[model samples]
Target: MNKLTLFIIALLLSPVAVAATPIEQRMADYNPDGNLTFDAKRGEALWHQQRMVDGKQRDCNTCHGKDLTQAGKHVKTGKVIEPMAYSANKERFTKLKKVKKWFKRNCKWTYGRECTTQEKGDLLKYLSQY
Candidate 1:
């Protein structure tokens, strides 16, 4: 076999590795004994922070309202959404996958960029505390 052929075989058999920062490695880390409670304060602050989007500045509260406790309805469809009260929506949040999806969407909407895992974790922690 030629050297190129051996190289190709090695590449196929080698493990795929991606580098991640320590914070990223630990962002998903949770303390089993530590409290996973919510802290609405941080979520509230993140929700209102203005960031650049499409070269324009915006924030989540621009559409979602500063106080998330009130029920919001789809302006056109009139579909209502519950307040982001943690206890009221505990079941929906038991799965981390669901939480990540929303974080990606909401982060882009509010910050115009995907939030770091730490930011997502912190936001989720704060929300859970509520």
Candidate 2:
């Protein structure tokens, strides 16, 4: 390549890459560890515990079996989704961006609150296991 083209390439690549956002950085702190393992256990408990939603006490296991490898379909919408801990579905989590997004939505749907970092890690561990 010509020197001018090389110089332009160098200039284009010179700027330092911007860092991820604080939320992303904080989320990064959620590596699977003992704490996450513990949280996963707790998440399992929570997933099974019935709670009042729309005046109905229901739980994830009410529809999804204790084993997360089973399939679940949305009764109201008739939409099919994979088992929460299905290994066959692992490729779907290739991006952490999508992982966090789904966690936020699903946790709320199941538990009515955003999961803790440890809980998130635990869920990931449990899913990875299956």
Candidate 3:
């Protein structure tokens, strides 16, 4: 009816507004009280943070490597992992289920505990930078 209403309608139909990546959508959902600001640095730090488990230090990078753009190998299984960056790998973050599956498996293996929603959001933020 009004110019403001028309603008809102246009924005709502816009691709950028409608096409939120699965990861982006998840991070937004993870936000607590709309106050969460996903920090890439914090994510990166968690990526590299070492935790000694069973006399061995492990981190996200232990299997994923430091470069999200490069393929990494699983330390234990010797399976090759795909690049994690959305820019580098188009399939990445395309599906929320896969992301959740890995987060659950990896967090347990590396951190020995399930990651918190904040941690998951932070890690997504970090990977987004690549």
| Residue 71 lDDT (model 3) | 94
Question: Is 1 or 3 the stronger prediction by TM-score?
Answer: 3
Off by over 4 Å in 1: 1-43, 52-57, 74-78
lDDT of 3 by residue, 50-87 (tens): 99988888988888877889998999898999998867
Q: Could you tell me which residue pairs clash in candidate 1?
A: 37-129, 38-128, 38-129, 39-126, 39-129
Prediction-by-prediction clash tally: 5, 0, 0
Clashing pairs in 3: none
TM-score of every candidate relative to the true structure: 0.53, 0.60, 0.81
Q: Model-by-model lDDT, in order? A: 0.58, 0.63, 0.84
Candidate 1 — worst ten consecutive residues by lDDT sum? Answer: 18-27
Candidate 2 residues lying further than 4 Å off, grouped into runs, are 1-29, 32-40, 62-67
User: Of models 1 and 2, which has the larger TM-score?
Assistant: 2
How do the candidates rank by lDDT, highest first?
3, 2, 1
Q: Which candidate wins on TM-score?
A: 3
What are the RMSDs of all candidates, in order?
13.8, 8.7, 3.0
- Report the C-alpha lDDT of model 1 over 1-130, residue by residue, as the tens digit: 9999999988876644444333223234533444444344765677668887567667755554445555555433767766554545544455556666777787876776898654666665555555
Indicate the worst ten consecutive residues by lDDT in candidate 2.
18-27
Model 3 residue 79 lDDT score:
99
